[model samples]
Target: MGEILLPLLILCPLAASMIVSVSAGRMGACAIGTVACTGVGISAVISIILSITLLSGPPAGVLQVTLWPWMHIAGFSADIAFMLDRVSMVMILVVTIVGLLIHVYAAGYMRDDPGIARFFGCMTLFVAAMLVLVLASDLLCLFIGWEGVGLCSYLLIGFWYNDPANTAAARKAFYMTRMGDVALLCGLLLLATATGSLRIGAVLAAVTNGQLAPSGVNLAALFILVGALAKSAQIPFQTWLPDAMAGPTPTSALIHAATMVTAGIYLIARLHDLFAMATPIMALTAILGTLTLLMGACTALVQSDLKRILAWSTISQLGYMFLALGCGVWQAALFHLMTHAFFKALLFLTAGAVIMRTGHEQDIFRLGGLRHAMPGLSAAFAVGASALAGLPLVTAGFYSKEMILSGVWHVHFGLTREWTLSGHPLWGIALLGAFLTALYIFRCVFIVFCGKKQGTSATGRTSRLMSIPLGCLCFLSLCGGVIEMPDTLPPLHLFSTLLDPKTPLSHADEPIWLVLAGALAPLAGLGVAWVLWGRATPVMHEIPGQAAIIRLARTGWGMDALYDRVFVQPFRLLTWLTHHDVLAHAITATGRLTQAVSGRIFQARTGFLDILSIWGSRGTGWMAYLLGQLDNGRVRWYAAWIAGGLCAGLAMAVLS
Candidate 1:
């Protein structure tokens, strides 16, 4: 069953996609979509079962399914193989389950579109690509899946290609991620060249066992990190994500929140053995994660577009995962990744439901009091938001996020030197970031659901199809916390035994004060938000310098403008020079030279006619004079001359 399960996990969706493409127009869009989604749900169930089985079985045993020999050279070979272990199992489970929910939701969300079949096809392809990425046994196999997902993202983001903005957004996502892809390819080549194996297990063992040099390993790791950063939309590469929101909301939920963006964290965690070689790179990852988290949180605070806000928040949450990885707490990072997938997907889907109801209005100020209209959706959104804000112990977000902060604290103060810059400071940043997270999330929740319906006459309701997923996810968001609780803290964590089997949580004595600080940060942020925006305050719209701040936040801290001035404009100018001045001028000059030569040749042909006419007239005059002399008043001579001239004209006409 294990051998059969891995390939079926990938093949099922791909086969369904092909069927949908062929039958969708005839069977109707909804029917085709339903079948595809049903297939995905089945795959999800299989993936979950596989994960449970793997967790219950031997930790070292890997289930490998080899499709074919991908490549063979003199000294190297690569295979299209899928390896199912603990890490890959976890990721596959997340992708398929969340993916199934999104697909079902999209059935209703995109019911009216003429291109619904295309949408389902693209989604199926995306699921297959992500599954391949997670299950890939070698770096080459993984890259194929990586590029595949990127392609799917571009297609989906530009689904409404008639909209120029959507097209540009898709292009931006493609190009930016391509840059990272190149880096990843280079890193993979380096690994293959150095270690002669792209298999994750082999490469990790080689690095961990000190068979590879620390410097070379770190460089390769850095190159890989570049790809992870771009694909995951970390700092400098993050601007693409906001633009990516130009895609349909369903695409947004799947790509940004659920699967694709989380790939970076997965990559780092999967290759933890390689990363452990270079402490500096790990520290950099932590710092970058911290900075990204702060930037995303601060940016989210100002975004008015509901999707854009979620986009930034996704980037922020991903940063926390990286932070956890940076601190050498792989389990914590993976835990957060799981919890985040649940809540974030829930938030985006619920937002989509609200948008669909309100005729696609995403502005929070223009939306309000949805709680009464969409009770289930409202409840789901609230649950998700609570988790997002890491509110208490009710949601998955609290446990996972708490675990991350706890890991940072333990590694920073407990395990490392106190005065080290990379140590305690990361913990401090994590705590501060948690506070900001609470503030913006509560603000979003309050504005969208708590107040009077903004510019509305009545409440808008969601459909049963939409409400079901939200309800399910809301339950998951609440109960998912039980999967990752520290043994010292709780008894219900099913996942506690699955990770770090060699070292139990009981051995890592984490300080209570650190836990208190992490917990308190979100509480503080929530309190501030309630005080500022929860009620019908007198200064609600009369905020001091609110206009400037709101404008700044809405503009994403002027990062886009800065990028335009610093990068886009310069690039445009260079392109203009290269295309217009260099290539264009060369082509234009060559064209003119050809035209001039052709014109001279044409002039030579016309000159031949003038010369011929001059000669012909002179010759004709001589002949006519001689004929007159010979004629001697005879009409025969004149007749002869006329006949000769007529014969000459006939010959000339034939020649011409």
Candidate 2:
């Protein structure tokens, strides 16, 4: 039964989405919601069953299902094949489970909106695309899924296309990711040229057999890294994500927490061996991850909007995953990715509840004293924030983030003798980012739910549908880390061990002192936040010299402006030249050349024609005068003239 359902997992949601679109007008809101939930629910069930089957066997187990030959041209061929490997199995369950929950939440969140059908359709399509991306057996199939999700993101982000801001945001997200997509395609072509394989299994198999050259693998990994970074919204490619909150909160959870943003991590994880083949690329990736982690944490500190804060937090957490991958501890990265998904979804949903309750007010400065108004959701928010802050041993984030920091600590210690040494800057940046993450999150918590309410606010109750998922996610956020216990005492390392201790996992065995520092870092951050903002009211403006600093953080370190001036503006100029300058000038020049040639032809015709006409009239007059003279019939004169004329005519005739 599991085998029968594994292949249809992606299709279930897709089919349901299509049915909803067709029946949207005929169906009521409840019916449409039911259809959407049912489809996702079915896929989630299949994922669980298939996971059980694989988990029951050896961790090496993989379920490969081939639908048909998708393409065959010359030597290059591919199938619509899916692989349920251990890593992909994790992704499948994560996408479906988290995705189904988000869909249910969206049903309640967007209940009153008339465009519910459009939202649900796009949501399910995204779900389908993500599942395919994670499960794809070949680069060709993965690209298909990759493109599908990009399209869906554009549609869903601009779900409220009436607003120009939303449209612009949708365009930003689409075009920004498009740059990485182009690089990704180029990398795929290069990989295919080097190895002549599109199937990931064959590619990895070739790597295992030591068939690929080092330089080619490194180049391929670099280009793919650019795509991953852009898709996952890391560093320079991260500008679009915060703006993407112009979409609804459910969309935020869907894109940021669980599905689209994690694609980069999954891609790197999927091609784990290829990246491992080139250590320099991994180091470079680690550097990017560390810098982005701090960048996000810094910017998140000053953000006023609740969703934007979470958005930046998502960026920071994703950087940790990237850091882990770069350090060659992909198991830690994957664990963090899973745990981050849960808490982030919970946080976003709870924030959505707050916004709904307070008349869609998202500004932390304006919202306050919500601890009493929405006690249930407020408690839920606290759970999520605690998990995100990575405070101590109780939360899921503590274990996962500590795993990443543990890897960083090991790297630092390996480079320098002392564990506390600052020789390796990534270790320092990651730890500091952890502290800032806690401070900023709790700061928002203190300002919103703990401070005084600014004014009269509306009240909207959260439905049981929304409440139930929040409760489940809240429980999971608190306890999910137990899956892989840290080694302060007897630890399980269950998540790491399940991936097998043959390669990277064996070294990731229960990190020691790093967990201790990581544990304290968040506690200190929370303490500072409590002291500073716990009793203080929100301020309207920045303090004199602090304005510049605040502006820098608010502008995401001016990355957007830099990209605009560097890439977007330059590209726009080139486009303008093509349409309005270069192309037009070429056509205008061709016309001028034709006109010049015509003017020379006109000169040759008209000027010489006038001269010839004058000469022709003069010659006719001379002939008439000679004819008149010949007719005069003067005896002697006529005889002499006639003889002269005959001699001249005979001489001319002979010469001729």
lDDT of 2 by residue, 160-206 (tens): 99999999999999999999999999988887776677899888777
Whole-model Cα lDDT per candidate? 0.84, 0.86
Which residue ranges in model 2 land beyond 4 Å of their true spot? 412-423, 456-458, 501-512, 536-547, 573-582, 589-656
Worst ten in a row by lDDT for model 2:
412-421
lDDT of 2 at 314: 92
| Cα deviation of 284, candidate 1, in Å | 0.6
Stretches off by above 4 angstroms in model 1 are: 412-422, 457-460, 491-493, 504-508, 542-553, 577-656
What is candidate 2's CA lDDT for residue 255?
81
